[model samples]
Target: MTTQATLTPAKELAAKNRARFPNESAEYRQARNALLAEEIELRRHIERVAERRRQLPPGGEVTKDYRFEGENGPVALADLFGDKDTLIIYSYMFGPEREKPCPMCTSLMASWEGKVPDIEQRVALAMVARSPIERLVAAKKARGWRQLKVYSDSDGSFTRDYVSADDADVPAYTVFTRRDGTIRHFWSAEMSSEMADPGQDPRDAPDPDPLWTLLDTTPEGRGANWYPKLEYPSAG
Candidate 1:
């Protein structure tokens, strides 16, 4: 692998960036330039991580033909793949005990609803919850999410096997591949709170949600006490 030093230095690339803002101080520009170099390196690191993920060998074969209760009716694990060879499933933290769906998961899905059509062109995407199908559908309708496909893992077999063995109210993002006549696990967001750095939230490297990405560019940077809510009262 080519090192950043061997290739063009991130500092040099950042130095070449002629972008400027109105009335920015020289000190700010200096600090911004330094930050830009780090951003360049971060971009490179992200690309490397993605390459490593793509290079991963075939994971465990999915032996269990897990069943799910879709809005339409019952569906199998293979049915979620549809015509695509790759499938991405988000195990929502909407278990029966919770009064409402997870706010973080809901925020992520709200962003995903619009991109579903474009994303489904290459890979199938589904959001599965341990709640009943009727409940999941109701929440979907209430949220005005039309593009995302929601499924209910009524038996908890799929959630137990792939998500949490104890049926914990934790969300999981897993990818699976269906090639030829067999299906196998691809990759999963295994990073947990235990692996997180001090003061940093447990999140995947290439975050699936746009909320964090957008906030990261701002000074506040995902406030510690702030979190998405199921519903917000109308300003009107």
Candidate 2:
């Protein structure tokens, strides 16, 4: 792969002298164009990665009887699948002490809740956590996440097996498939980085976190790297 120099000195100077500071020059134009090209290529790479992830093999039979609850009442892991061929579970980070949802996880979950109908059409979705089921449920209610299928993984091992344990841990989005009364593992995405860019292969960063994106628009600039307390303005 050819590495494009998107951070030439010229680009730096131009960025420092943008519309907010307005000092147009030929060098700046060249640098800007180069940066734009690089960005376009990066986006294309991200699209390819998404496609590749979609094609990954669903391994392991996971028909184990894991039980939990939802708005619809008592549910098993299999029930979450909703007769679909695939099951997608998300390991949320809302712990017992969370007076509010983790900003990043909340952002992702809130978005998922919005996309639930569409996401459900393609894959069964659920947010799992080790917190007590009631605690998790209350947090979800407070967040107004009515559509999301929130569940408790209080046993802890379920999360350990999937590799999402602790606050700093990355939320894991795992996919599974059911066949012959058994479930198989499929695709999984782990967010190890604190600040992720949604751009392409983020082996170095988490995807541009939607929460950060939303918060960044405000003058706070994501507020000294601190997140929004689930209780909101009152939490501080």
Q: Please, what is the TM-score per model?
A: 0.95, 0.68
lDDT, model 2: 0.67
Per-residue error for 93 in candidate 2, Å, reads 1.8
Cα-based lDDT at residue 96, candidate 2: 59
lDDT of 1 by residue, 38-107 (tens): 9998988887888789999999999997999999999999999999999999999899999899999999
Best candidate according to TM-score: 1
Candidate 1, residue 202: the lDDT equals 89
lDDT of each: 0.92, 0.67
lDDT score of residue 151 within candidate 1:
97
Worst 10 residues of 1 by lDDT: 1-10
* lDDT per residue as tens, model 2, 20-61: 226768786766667756665566577667776666775777
Residue ranges of candidate 1 with Cα displaced over 4 Å: 1-6
